[model samples]
Target: MSSLGRHHDPIVAIATAPGRGAVGIVRASGKQLQPLVDALIGAPLKPRQAHYGPFRDATGQPIDHGLALFFPAPNSYTGEAVLELQAHGGPVVLQLLLARCLEAGAGIGLRLAEPGEFTERAFLNDKLDLAQAEAVADLIDASTEAAARSASRSLGGAFSAEVEQLAERIVNLRMLVEATLDFPEEEIDFLEKADARGKLAAIRAAVDAVTARARQGALLREGLRVVLAGQPNVGKSSLLNALAGAELAIVTPIAGTTRDRVSETIQIEGVPLHITDTAGLRDDAEAGDEVERIGMARSWESIHSADAIVFLHDLTRLADADYQAADARIAQRLATADPARLLQVFNKADTGVSAGSDGRLLISARTGAGLEALRQALLKRAGWQAAPEGVFIARSRHVQALKQTAEHLAGAAAHASQADQALDLFAEELRLAHLALQSITGRFSADDLLGEIFSRFCIGK
Candidate 1:
């Protein structure tokens, strides 16, 4: 259906989770919900007041006894009339209540709400901007306490306000430049007199500050993907268990015990680390089984795609000639595969093995030695910095948009340097920069982009 058609129709959904709880919510939003409310409760409801009553079905039989709430238009979520039925939490009871809403509101064109359609409606109605709408989902899907707090801040408009402020500054600068562009004779001198250059520099500095905070937020939202790669029986599984603080993978002394990838997510200092322990990488043609070959292929794929690769080494075998040869081959492959994301970690340090040179860290997963250092090193490799309070949750798209804004600002600065001959160019650059910033707050977002963003949200939100 067309978006306009969907928006005009009354939408209903079970707002609470699918299982039994103390209470469940069946919510509906529309232009006017008095008819539906009257049909369900068999009485009129006061706006913003909770009316304890029995919800009835089409047959005039009680479906459930619940609390009913009526939110009038322009004051409710989605800026429309909203009706909420707080029913008993049994799955059957909620389903019955939901069915009754659909049946009762059918005459008014009520239908099941599409995923995120409610929040999408809220965005369309100016109840929340694009970033804040996305934060609703981020807050729901947050995996850590810090991530939840960041998402909450974004939902509270912290991120949108910053973007809007930057956009406003850009707009003001564009007006100044455009005014100067209108008079070619006094363009250069007028721009200098207005301190346009100083304002541009100040705006750029603010953009840089917001960009830095957005990077930290993106780190919190997406976290880091780290893969552990080494020869078989090198304590890779042991390290995984130690980092996760759980026996997530099987650790055997036999080579190739882990013939597949074992994955776990562990948080360090409120930042989640998605760690994957891959099968041991070996070049033994005689020992290659069919399953082991596939496992090794997958391991290489993980290494190439990971945010960081932990190249684990058994310190006890560092002196062995054969082991040294294998380690050299692995190092050569790593050197070719983005050395910046690779961290050399020597394990089994408790076995009386001295540390190696070349920025390698020596630790023992068995003894929990140097694990904290390894955690810190992983965070560093991911380019994650500790964010200050009130940092909002951000996505990669937000980062890219800010980057585009920064580029446009840089272009504007270049044009401003030659204001006498390039006033038009400078004004155009500032306009483009303002539009890019608007994309973050939904002032200039594409319809398809809006669809993609809101489609990820759960139904009833």
Candidate 2:
């Protein structure tokens, strides 16, 4: 399926990190790197060979001396000719070398690489599939070892291979059903056979397996967004520091100390946790109007937008008027909030609060009390498994697609129950659903989607 004239022209860019380092790399790919090679190193280069050379300007003066590597067509990153020049990482040196390549290849039309343009080219050239291309970004953005491993599985096509297998099974069953289309007489017996239902059941089971693992992968990759909210100085900051095991938040006896949202990512038993501590709710007459207003706004946001809320309560001060008022306010927030992803926690149990209700937990962040219960609560919320051996990362788009596909399948089943068994029509519906599942794995790709995805990746990925 390779296009014959799909050379994207030569693109040159700095692959290494910006700013000074030991050395910086300048890379070029396309049909013609000869001009750049000849001008930069003063000679045409052999494929995959590293040659010592001096990069020159248009007038043939030395710009910088360094090692040059050349990869010829159909074997490079973009499936075309590639050239690399490594020079000192100084900003001045890289600029000089890049200017040289542009001038040398100007006649052949060289363009600057956009952010992730190189990887997008790789995807277009069939060097990587859609899922693998996305995995490139996931791998870069992975925070924990588990996320990295899941992303690696995605890149290796473990996820896509599962989808393809399921798609093939669905197609085969459709083929069996379609086999009776030519001979109307044998259709009833063929459709009534026990084997037909069994095959459909097996396909359903496979879909279920793939979906469950994809869900696990998604939870791992995206992590849980846990927001802490309570009256001022109820140990919200202390809990963040305890869970994070570091002073990520400034803790003091002074209430409303944390004026801004402080966030930290910590792993609790292989599950990545995104914890946010916001300004606590309180009634302060002398408080800055903007600060109170902003804090109240953020409290509402965290309550509704968070994946889960750890509603901290100071056990010692629960009877206090201001603290009681804060609790009532939370009840009001919940009534008006998103009505999903909420949890309640009573902190400072070491000060003598016995135990929490069935759905709540009491903890002392200072003494590490109730931390295990807290961690387990989060793990349960995230649907985290101990071992994500076969997990494959999924986006919200993937989740929504799978859901739609399931809906289509449900409709097909209902149609069949109503005795409308023009299974060719049913099969086509299944096919659409199957295609949606395939989109998760890159089986049916759109050019624009690929563009958007790889454009978010860092260059040289």
Candidate 3:
């Protein structure tokens, strides 16, 4: 069906999650829901008020006793009339209720809602902007309390507000620049009088600030991928166990005990870290078997892809010549890695092994010593700045948009600073920057991008 036609039709879905619960919601939204309401309840329901009643089938058979709610057009979630049935959360019950809704509204072309269709409609109807619409999904999928709070902030229009404010500033600057573009003789004098350079500088600074916050928010939403990498038996598994507070990885004294990656997600101060303890690093020829060799290869793969690498070291074994040689080899391979993301952590500090001044963290996975410091370090590596104020959740795309805006603003600044003062170029840059900021709140977004984004949402959102 055409997008227009599909969206115009009445849509129904079991609004609650699948499985039994104390209550479940079956919802319908459309331009006109009076016919469906009459077919289901036989009487008009007070808007926004829940009415306790028995939901009957076409044959007048009571399918379930529940609460019914009606929200008339322009005052509902999708800016359309909405109907909600609060019913028992049993799978069969919801399915039957859903079927009944379709049956009753068949005349109105009511159909099952597609994934994220409800929220998408809300976006289309101006009830929510693009960023706020995305927050609906992010809130549902948040892995940590901080992430949830951030998503809630975004849903409450915090992120969109920032973007809109930034866009408004850019628009005002664009208008000023474009206004001066037609008058070549007066352009320089007009811009100088208006302090265009100063305004552009301030806008650039604002973009930078918002971009930094958006980066931190993206970290909370997406989390970090951290890989524990070093020679075999470097206490990687033990450290993983300590960080996770669970024995998620098998820890054995024997070398090559772990032949694959064992991962666990643990939060430190509301930021999730997806920590993966990989099979110990070793020379391909030194691997004990084909499985171990494949495991080592996979470890390298994880190491290369990880956002951060915990170069775990066994303080007890650092003095051993064989271990040193192996550690040196691993370090050589890791030399190409970004130094900022690579952390050298010496383990087994409880063994009384003195860690010399290398400025590396010293910890004992066995005793949980210095684990807190390690967590802070990981957060630092991820560039997480825990603001005292609430942060709105953002995606990588939002970060990219902010960066694009900054780049265009930089171009505008360059044009403005030139001795010749290219007013047209300056205006064009401002226009582009404005559009970039608009894309964040979906004021200017491609149809395909919208589809890809909403497709990730759970059905009925």
Q: List the residue pairs that clash in candidate 1.
A: none
lDDT of 2 by residue, 1-461 (tens): 12213336677888888889998999888877777776778776777888887888888788788889988767877677778898889988998888777877889989777767776677677777777777878888888888888889988889878777877877786676567656567646654573665676677776777777777778778889999988788999999999999989999998678887889999876568899998877655635567766875777677677888888888888778966887887667676654456667889989876554666588899999999899988887777767547777766667766776676666555544543256666667677778887787666867666666666766654
Worst 10 residues of 3 by lDDT: 1-10
Runs of candidate 3 exceeding 4 Å displacement: 1-5, 185-188
- CA lDDT of every candidate: 0.89, 0.76, 0.89
**lDDT for predicted candidate 3 compared with the true structure:** 0.89
lDDT value, candidate 1, whole model: 0.89
Residue 285, model 3: lDDT of 85
Ten-residue stretch with the least lDDT total in model 1: 1-10
Q: Write the per-residue lDDT of candidate 1 for residues 255-363, one digit (tens) a residue.
A: 8889899999988777889999999988848345888988888999999999999999998888899998988887888787888899989999899867756677888
Per-residue error at 388 for model 3, in Å?
2.1
Which ranges of candidate 2 are over 4 A from the true structure?
1-7, 283-288, 336-340, 356-360, 418-420
TM-score of 3: 0.97
lDDT of 3 by residue, 80-197 (tens): 8889999988999989989988998888899898888888899999999999999999999999999999999999999898888888898888887777776667636856788899
